[model samples]
Target: MLLVLVFSLLATCSTAEEKAPADSTPLRLTDVSTAEAFINSAEVVVVGFFKADEGNGFKEFLAAIEEVKTLPAALCSVKEVWTNYSINSDTITIFRKADLHQENLQLSKIKKLDSDGLVRFLTINDIRYITEYNQASAVGLFQSKVKVHLLLFANRGSTDYKPLKERLGALAPRYSGKMLFVLINGKEKANERALGYFNLKSSDLPRVGIYDGESDKTWLMAPGEISIERVQNFCDSFVTGELQKEKQAGESEAKNEL
Candidate 1:
């Protein structure tokens, strides 16, 4: 299985490299150190491991990246770097820091070999530590293996919006696979529904909420300042199942009272 996957991505190129549009130039990653730096340099990065720059899917990789425009892409022909990733030969991989996921795309295995399909691959795996909620990005967020989300609701142009978003981005990696931190722009009319689902309004901007996909349960932090310590405690409460237990206990108490 492994052998079939790593089979040289370049060797299977039946066609010459198509000229990748110059929308974005892919960085050349020559060594393991450079590769590591590049991987950590962004919340998400697309790295193509090919035997040569002009190899199979190389052009497609470049062209596909041009279409996405949000991710940084790199090309690594070094076998040393390939081994570090546990792939033998050539594959395009999405290295995401948020969930610590390495999504691999092999050209030989793909039925369609075109820039369109490659673009889909890049977008679908574009999950980041702090992904803004949107139509295109929502695909990646919902499809993510991590089912839980820590949501930050803030009006886009508000005073504290960017600062709160950055604060959560730095905290996201700490939770990694446990939760996907998302920014919900309250100003966007489309997001009004999300705010309503949490029984919140735009007036209640700059709030924190947790949604557990597995149980379809939603939690909103008790109205207060959205401090890092408070948010961290809320996340910890969720992870420890304390939040669920508390809810259940409250229900039990109500039943007793009745």
Candidate 2:
């Protein structure tokens, strides 16, 4: 069987993706303009392009979509739209507006197609509002159109972990389109480098930080209680320009020290 390769565009843009209905049937795409509309209409979408009769893997794709109602899905039988996406043959493509990512799974290359495999593929790449940071998901995070990230750092098994994650996750959507929320598990050995980037250790958690991707700047929220109100205020401060003002003040102080 062939593996999955997700390709990022030169830049990222967004419309927004709404959760599909419980029925989970893919929207029928008929033309180039409509295809363009569907792709741009969401943060992520999966569209299977086939010649007719919803060719190979369509049944499996259907099963996968039912399990992943969070991602919008569609079917394109029209060959004309395929060329626009550089799709020459039967393919299942996952489109993401966050990073302008286009991932293609060629049916011709896959020796076997199973609903379970398709489900894994879709769920693994299904970057949500508050996503856990990992090697696999880092691909989606870096591709986000939203340059600023509000990150939650916590240990996996700690008493405060689950509630903190859920708290921030609930508060996350409030900053949607403005910022991306990321969870960094301090317990993961693989994430040590990420911890080091923030000059943090597992002992120093659970902390909150803001990373501005555009300028490659990072700021740690003051060490104290990690309350939802505090997190909300921290996010609002960045949005209200207080954070940038503070950065400028710190720069001025450094100059004065000089």
**TM accuracy, model 2:** 0.63
lDDT of each: 0.78, 0.75
lDDT of 2 at 240: 96
Best-fitting candidate, measured by lDDT?
A: 1
**Can you write out model 1's per-residue Cα lDDT over 149-225, one digit (the tens) per residue?**
99998887789988998888888888998899988788776666677667778998888988777777777777788
lDDT of 2 by residue, 1-258 (tens): 001111211111221224435447789998999999988786678998877765788788888888878778998888778888999888888886433468788988988788888876775566656777754466656665677889898988899988898899788868767888878888777666666656788999999998887777766787899998999999999999898789666955533432
Candidate 1: clashing pairs of residues: none
Residue 123 displacement (Å), model 1: 2.7
Give the worst 10-residue stretch by lDDT in candidate 2.
Answer: 1-10
Off by over 4 Å in 2: 1-51, 56-124, 251-258
lDDT score at residue 224, model 2, on the 0-100 scale = 91
After superposition of all CA atoms, the RMSD between model 1 and the true structure is 10.0
Q: Which segments of model 1 are wrong by more than 4 Å?
A: 1-23, 251-258
